[model samples]
Target: MIRLSQDNAKSLLAIHGWSGALLGLLLYAVILTGVIAVFADEIGGWSSPLQHEPATALPKGLGAKLAELSTQVDEQYHDDLFFFPQAGGRIRTFFHKDIVVDGQPSAEGVEFDLDPNTLAVLDRREGISETIQQRNTAGALSAFLVDLHVRLHVPNPWGLLLTGALGLAMMVAAVSGLIVHRHLLRELFTIRCRRQDLLAKRDAHVIAGTWNLPFAFILAFTGSFFSFASTVGIPVVAMVAFGGDQERLIETLVGVSPAEDKTPKPLADLDAMLADAHARVGVEPSFVSIAHYGRADARVNVFTPPSEGHVSSNNLVYDGATGAFMHQKPGLGLVPSAGGVLFDLMGPLHFGNFAGVLSKAIWFALGFAACYVTLTGMLLWATRRAESQAWQRLARATIWVGYGLPLSLAASPIGFFIGRSLGIVELHDSMAIAFLSAAALAGALALSLRDLESLRRVLLAATGAVLLSLPLLRLATGGPGWASAFASGLQAVFSLDLAMLVGGALCVFAARRPNARLAAAARSGIEDNQSQPA
Candidate 1:
């Protein structure tokens, strides 16, 4: 019994330490990416402002432009084509196929270019040029960062598995963190900075962690669900618990695919289909998925945006070839299907994008708080044992990872713009080079710890400068100026630019703090506020 207890105790400690350390930096990255990703559409819109600008109306040859590009891509790539007209503010063309490329099948992605007012391609020549290939959408960077946060951008399964491991670790840390600080509930909202320094540090951690526990828990759980579906076999659980059959199992969990057709005739007029779907759902149609086009019985799935102040499992469907209403399903209810509700809640709850501008702003605030929570937790771990060289080393490492990640990430847009301006043949390669280089430099600086305060000030100043230049960059790239963006209701770019400017100012304020040794010591509860670093 003693041996087993000892083993369990060691295991628990290992879980606490390793999980907190492993996820702390990555969680910070995830929170930052997620907050930015909430406006992915806006960023994408900003990148191609021409698509959303006030035109007299959509150009007359939208169909011709799509058809021309479709033929070129289909002939060249030999794949099924999906054309998203006015998708997230730009037209995107996807070429999909099941074939081995570089010894890997299921290699899928889209080739996109700006929509042309004339029937000509956005670029001079066809075949996916460098500009069209570059993806600098508002949410693109955030999504890429999210990929880093979740799977470190490895292949799909591998990234999911690793992230799942991290999620499990986080679950353990959260539970343990709650236990470690259980006695401090009465002090949750109170911060007494004048108390003993260590008490003050401890107090800050307690307050931030406690007040935001609910939001943190929700984020962790939802993030885990995404990684866990693949790792923990939650889908398998759905299959076994609900029924033995896979298709039926999916249906029970998410929703039944109301009857589909294999030989559906070609859809006639999408305008008619749109009107029919709008009348049924009373919501603007977001996406329309057509299955088995050019057949006798075609199914067109129209998705409705989640309603305000409510989480829904409802999806409205219509027949494409026939223009008939198929079915309407509500997402959450008494005895709601677990799989269904989870599927429905994934986008809204995870990204907080469903509630429009105010909700998204609130979501962004909470996300930043989560980032601070993760940072503070790691700092607490290091400061408690500040005398140890190992602890000091780790503290330096965390500072680099935290501040440096933002620094490198903030430089990516500028990198993209630079690469584009320089006429780089391959945009992704240019972006990769830029991001990796910045990250490497940041990591190197982190290790040196030459002068932590100096580094912090430099990074803050750099971030501030980079953020302040966004609007100017937009104008330089033929995008509208502030007056035009405001007049056209394309405020996403201006809004994002202002947020970055404000964020830069905050960094400046933080940098104004006395100095590094002093900051570290203050954080460690080892120095008097009025005193300088020893």
Candidate 2:
């Protein structure tokens, strides 16, 4: 156990509480979205399924189809080409050229969405990479959720920096929590239901936080690394090492910059190379990129998600002209290095995709507990200061966000399904509008409601009702029934449907009891605060 002087302990306790209450609001948002995003692939699959289930991700004759699609785009975009399967088994390909935008490396190009079974072009868009990414429909809901989690729907560099700072804040909170809790191991099992309302809630919060410490640290560290590596870390290193040329630094870190081989060479059989990669790695490649396409020096990079028993994904290289297997390339530099290993490990560690569904489930549970710790921390802090009107307002705001967020999230897919059913293109905007509208409505109810527990109950029930309606929405939008989905190998659709049902039932059950602690002081003030409008 960590031992500190009483003064030191009190000081740390103050810092931990205020920091968590201030930063924990946004941190809670990130963690909640992240917990949901652990099932993003499943969510995507359930959202935008194709007409037929395909046997493989990299469909046959894609090379020829890509060659045909290449003719439609400008020659400059031929310099870089990549294709990957969206969660719904749709193949999305980007034919683009690298360009620096806003002093950072970006892509300006055209993208195509193809049917995995028939190779039919489903949609096409041309623009900067970020804009086009936002317009994607195949995985629209999951993509939006992930974007919210990663950057809270903000633009790059700034968004990344914000989340990275949040990650550092989380690390500090976890560390201080460990120290201030003192007997974390003992607290893990010492929740006292018979104590005062505030103390019981505090015990529950401490217990959850203690159980989540290790995973919280891992998530924070890796989240910080991922958020900063591209935005701050890479830029600083490039400014120092290559005189501020990011493109040059990227090429150098990628191993070797072979001499310009613009000499024309018909690209080799990409299908064979992809098949070879699957055979050798024993896992499907998540993404395939061909650099210097149609040139003698073109190299194909196949990146696979972590195989069984591994934390990091693997990348295989092949000759783009000859289709010959070259080598299994590391993420950075030619030889195995500490940086590459760290880079690779960070992804699986932060995202928990290493062991597929099992690991993702574990991450989701831990993340949910972390969210609980954050919320209860805020409540405990505000509850202590509840005698002050200002603190009462904070408590109300916390109640609004903590309860209202899930309601808003549950309302989003309603928009997604409605937009798709209406044949609307660019579904993200509609979904965002739905999310914001739900939030606004929740806020209004929170202000108008007379009691904090009443506000929680209303939002929780609303969330439950929306979640309960989702499966019906899916079916109304042409989605297969559970029996049909299971028969056709679309298990994700059925599984997620069942999950929503269970979640909705649980939410409704919880709302009926309204066990959330609102603190005696805050509970007392709610009558007057409701009259005062704030």
Candidate 3:
């Protein structure tokens, strides 16, 4: 146990309580959304399942397709090329060159979506990168959820800054909680449900919080690093080390070619190079980026997921002009330096994707527990001061958000299905409308209810009902049925459908469970500290 004097402990407790009380709701929203976003790829596949899973992200004959498309686009776009898999195993290929947009360098390109198996062009778009990104519809559901977690849907820099501050506040609370909770080990198993109702609730909060402290710290630190790296860290470094030349700073850090060579050359076959990379790395490539395509100084980088027993993947670089292997390099630098090692470790550590599905499941469970602890802790604090009208209002708001948020999230898929069926161009707007509509309903219910028990039961039931209907809605909107999906080798769709059904059932069960203690506490009218049990 961490030993502290009485005064020190009191101060630490104050810090912990206030920090959580101030940012608890927003932090809970982030953690809960992140838990779902961990399965973003699976969600994308489930929402937009293909006829069959592809054998590889980059299939044979892709080079011919690229060459044919290259002849059609503007010559300036020949400067750079990128390819990656998108929702439902569709491959997205883009050819672009840098152009100034509002004093910033941006790509103007033609992007094509192809069927991984047939190599048939599924869609084509041409515009500035930003506009193209805004118009792309693949993985719309997963993208919306991820954006909510990453930025709360606010504009960049400001949203990133707000989330970064929240991360720091979470870190402070986690550390101070450790210091204040003197019996951490004992508290791990403690649940004093036989005592007073308030004590039991408080003990539940403490136990979960203690078990979750380490994970909370890990998430906070990594989350803050990601949020600030682009918005603040890179710019600061550019100012100090590169004289504010962000482009040059990136080139140096990423080990780009130092010499300039603009002479045109016949581009090597990318399909052959991809095969070579898979043979060397023992895994399928995830992304391929080419710079200065068709030029003597051209370079190609193939990025793969981590190999077995490895914490991070080594990116394979090749001479784009010759298709000859250059070197296998870590993510950040040419050689594995201290900074590179740390930077490479961050992705898997934060994402918990190092061990695949099992690790992701564990992270999701821990994240859910963290959300529970936050909500329960805030409720307990407000309940203790229930004599004050202001504190009572705070309690009502807590219940509205804690129970209401899930209902709103479950409602978003409904809008997604509806919009897709009608071929709506702006599905995100549809989702936002559905989510807010649910929230408004929940708020009205919260205001009308006299007690927390009623509000919880209603919201939980509503969420369960919405989740239960989602699969049916998906089916009605042209999504594959279970049998068809299974026959087509689309197990992701089947698994997600089953998971949603199970989740809905569990929520319904919880809503219907008898809560004797809450009923007893309500009957006693014990809303203040004066009603402590002997």
Candidate 4:
């Protein structure tokens, strides 16, 4: 009876440990990536020296740029032309369709990176060339990175599903973790690293997990919300509420479009439409939406920036034909609809995009802490599994992949510079694939090594060396040096580069830690304690 009870207890404890540890790994990746990506724009600014434009730098001449665009349209597409001005910061061209030059669309439209003073294309199609930047604060690389983190660079539906599952797993681990550490709340502020490795692991887990419980819950729940909607919400809601009709369910939740019944009419002025929308919103316009522009029942929707103590109820809809206000979308008031309010706040809460630099800095700090939690969790697991050769190999492989991924990601900018120098356009996708392949190779090599400590040391050393050289490498190329980045008011680049160097240095410290050698012995002692005859 005693033997059976002990065996059952051991099996249960082992099950819980492996489950929590495994799930924690994925959660750590998602959270860490999310935190870094919150300041995606800053990272992008750091990556390119050309992006370090001083505020005092002349705003690129709008008229000449517009004229150049018009000329491009005339040469390419002879259809009716409409010019869209980009938001100011970096520059990139978005080709608008259906512009006419000679009553036909021309085939030769070129988006020129214009010189700000002359409004002429930079036209430096040579070594270490620069592309025209966009007017938006968040540039293409930032946007792409955000998308990649959230969606794993997959299509919308599939990515959401995968991330959602990960979120669910995170929730499970967090909840179970809380339950497992009943004294977590009491020990929340403590850091008990002085204890032996097992107790230290428990203490670290409790302290980090307890204090950040709210944040962990929020990230997991919200992440799961979108994912659950597709995977679980749709099916349940559709079946129970709408008799299994997906379309009707969507319409009920989000509202359905009315049927078109009249002939098309001349479209109203977008500028005027915006003015009318502004009047209703009590704020300047940030986004404009137009539907069925040439029809009598056309609609125009304009959104404004959210204000303090307001839950961002800043949209105004109008009849496109008459420029008259339509009924306001529900959930804009002080006491808004639950679903709408949640959706509205999701963007600001997740990315800190709505918040300025200070807020983003806090978000980044939290993100680094989250990464710390993840790394510690993995290390703790590896300590427990140190005696198992196969498991040790697997754990080392995971560390290599995790560490190598970000390092490889850092290398992409260098790849971009090389591609530009080599006259290889469309290098982004090619470079990403190559980096991924290389990271895989690094992971395989690390796994193949017999000594885990040596592998960790090698990977950590390589990461430190590569990161330390990045800024110098940039300067050696046509890219800006550290001083130039500062001169151009690009604090993000300087800070980011510095952070990378510091992070690499820390990894080296961790890799070289002498005390880490005794982790396996400590784990063995604990396992023996639990297994010994009582």
TM-score of each: 0.81, 0.94, 0.95, 0.73
* TM-score pick, better of 3 and 4: 3
Measured by TM-score, the strongest candidate is: 3
Q: Give the least accurate 10-residue stretch of model 2, judged by summed lDDT.
A: 525-534
Rank order (by lDDT, best first): 2, 3, 1, 4
Runs of candidate 3 exceeding 4 Å displacement: 100-105, 516-534
In order, what lDDT does every prediction score? Answer: 0.60, 0.86, 0.85, 0.58
Better of 1 and 3 by TM-score: 3
Give candidates' CA RMSD values in order: 5.7, 3.6, 2.1, 7.5
Candidate 3 structure quality by residue, lDDT tens digits, 1-534: 889998888788788888878888898888888888898888888888788888777899988888888888987998899999988888989999989887656889999989899999888888998777665676688888888899999977788988888899999989998878888889899999787777887788888889899999999999999999999999999999989998888887786573879998867988899999999978889899988877898899999988888888769999988999988987886788888888988888888898989999999899999899888877776777667788778778888999899999899888888988888865788889898999999999999998888898889999999989999998999999998998888878989999999999988998998666655544443443676521
C-alpha RMSD of candidate 2:
3.6
Model 1 Cα lDDT, one tens digit per residue, 165-262: 66566667766556545355675777767755555665776677777767777777777778877555755775678564655555654555446555
TM-score (C-alpha, index-matched) for candidate 4: 0.73
Q: How close is candidate 2 to the true structure, as a TM-score?
A: 0.94
* Residue 204 in model 4: lDDT: 66
TM-score of 1: 0.81
